[model samples]
Target: MQQITGREAAVAVLNDPRFVVPPVPPGASGIAWLRATVGRFSSGPAHDRRRALAVAVLDAVPPATLRTGGGHPVTVLARALGIAEPVMDLVRDVAQAYQPGTGDESRADAAVDRLVTILGGRHDEPTAALIGVLTQACDATATLIERARHRPVDEVLHADPPVRATRRQAQVATTVGRVTVQAGEVVLVGLAGGPAFGAGPRRCPGWDHALALVAGALARDSPSVHEGTPDTAPGTGRD
Candidate 1:
């Protein structure tokens, strides 16, 4: 694996055609299927379409609303998505298992099944897209909230990013910085050194919504409400 730093190099690696996200296996069900189907793990045109769908979901939930809304981030987000009942626990479970090697997948799959039923009966693209939104917002937003306690959120993001790195695979032999990375190698891009959100096609679309959630939490709840929480890396979908 190669480690990439600095904003310019990060941008180059992110936009380079020879590098792509390491794709999850297809032909899966539940969380595995959601992992394979979402834009976060895909590249190229599939990513474009899926990301657009995700953006459309975010589009429906204005950041301003989230900034002033009441409730846990997951609950607020779920309600914003038009879910009436409480699904915070379910969303958190799915988010915990959304990334590879994270949690009990059976529980997460069952959570995904419930979420699917809540959104709409069919497990299709739009439903998958909404799940993608909730999963991405989970730990990442919480980590941001914790880190922003003293410093401004902008500084917390650049100087001390909650998710410090993002992984990209080299599809072909490529030179990143002074190092020549071979095909099938993984390069860890240091988000601490890069442009905000991200710098290329996979840039986060729900940034405003994320920031708004963080701000709203800061305004609504005391930090003690989150005391003694287990340390977790932000969800793996930083970009």
Candidate 2:
């Protein structure tokens, strides 16, 4: 694995057509399957379609809806998608699964199953898109809330990004900056020190809403109230 840390180098690698998001190996299932199915892990037209669906779903919710002090952004987004149950538990499990090698396979699968059911058991593209939204936002929003307690949210996001890094596989022999990368080699784009959200094509789509949510949470006299609380807290209703 080659780690690309320079901002320009990382951006080049991420945007170049000669590189693609790698796929889960054959026979991988459970959380790995969920990861692979999401737009974040795909390339080509599939990525385009899924990404558009996710952006549409996120865009449909007004920024004020996320900042109304009603519920965690994850819950608010879930409710907007028509899921009636409290979804923080499922969000937590999926968030853990997003971290490399941190989630139990069976547990993550169960979480995905429950989340799919909450999204109406349709198992269609829209359902998967909504799942992508929750998984992508859950941990990042939580981290932002915790870190904002000690420093400015922008500084916290720059110093310790929710996504520490992202990986891409070379599709053809290519050069990123001065480095020549061989086909099939993995290139790690370091995000912690690069940019706040990310760079290039794969930059986070939920960045605006995430910032709004964090700002709203911090505006509260008790920001920690949103940190790890159960979804059952009073006044945690939909926006």
Candidate 3:
């Protein structure tokens, strides 16, 4: 495995075509299966299709709505999909599942099952894509909200990013920042000082939605309540 920490080097590796997002191994179960279906884990044509779907779905909901106290973005999205479950509940479940080595497996599985049922049980592309949006946006936005009360949001994101790191696999031999990476080698990109929403074909599709959610939440909450408080946001358990 190769680790890239320098911001410029990390961006170069992330933007290069020779390095690809590592694929989830086959036969993943439970929360893993849901994660595998997300666009971030896909490649080539499948990635393009899922990414378009994600963009279209997210785009349908204006950022202004989030900023104007319209509702939680997840709730809006769930209503758009005709799902009746409480949006924050679902977000909490998915967020817990996404955390590594934390959360109740059985509870997470049940949440996935409930979401799958609500989306008509096939776990099709659209359902998976929407879940991906919620999973990616929910906790991270909440974290940003919690942290921003005491510091600038950008600083919070830089010091404790939503995604601390990402791994890529070299599809072909390539040199990244004077380092030769062999085909099939793994590269871990440290994202603390890297691009905020990633820097390549696999950049997160929910950047706007997340920012809107954070902005809306901040706009609605009193700064006095959150100031100098440690993050006690929901779904922020150890991952």
lDDT of each: 0.79, 0.68, 0.67
Tens digits of per-residue lDDT, candidate 2, 1-239, equal: 67777777866766677877776542234466566666777788878888888899888877676776546667766766666789878877776655346556677878887777767776566776788788776766766677787898777767766556677789888878777789898777666555656666767888888887777777773535345532321111001
The C-alpha stretches of model 2 lying farther than 4 A from their native spots are: 25-33, 223-239
TM-score each candidate: 0.92, 0.85, 0.80
lDDT of 1 at 69: 68
lDDT for each residue of candidate 3 in 33-55, tens digit (9 for 90 to 100): 76677676777888788888888
Clash pairs (backbone) in predicted model 2: none
Residue ranges of candidate 3 with Cα displaced over 4 Å: 27-29, 70-82, 99-105, 178-180, 222-239
The TM-score obtained by model 3 is 0.80
Clashes (backbone N, CA, C under 3 Å), per candidate, total 0, 0, 1
Tens-digit lDDT track for model 1 on 1-239? 57888888878887787878888888456888888888888888898899999999999998988877676677778888888878878877887777677788998899988988888777888888988898777777777788787788989888877676778899888787787889898878777754557767788898889899988988886543234334455336455
Error of model 2, residue 11, in angstroms: 1.5
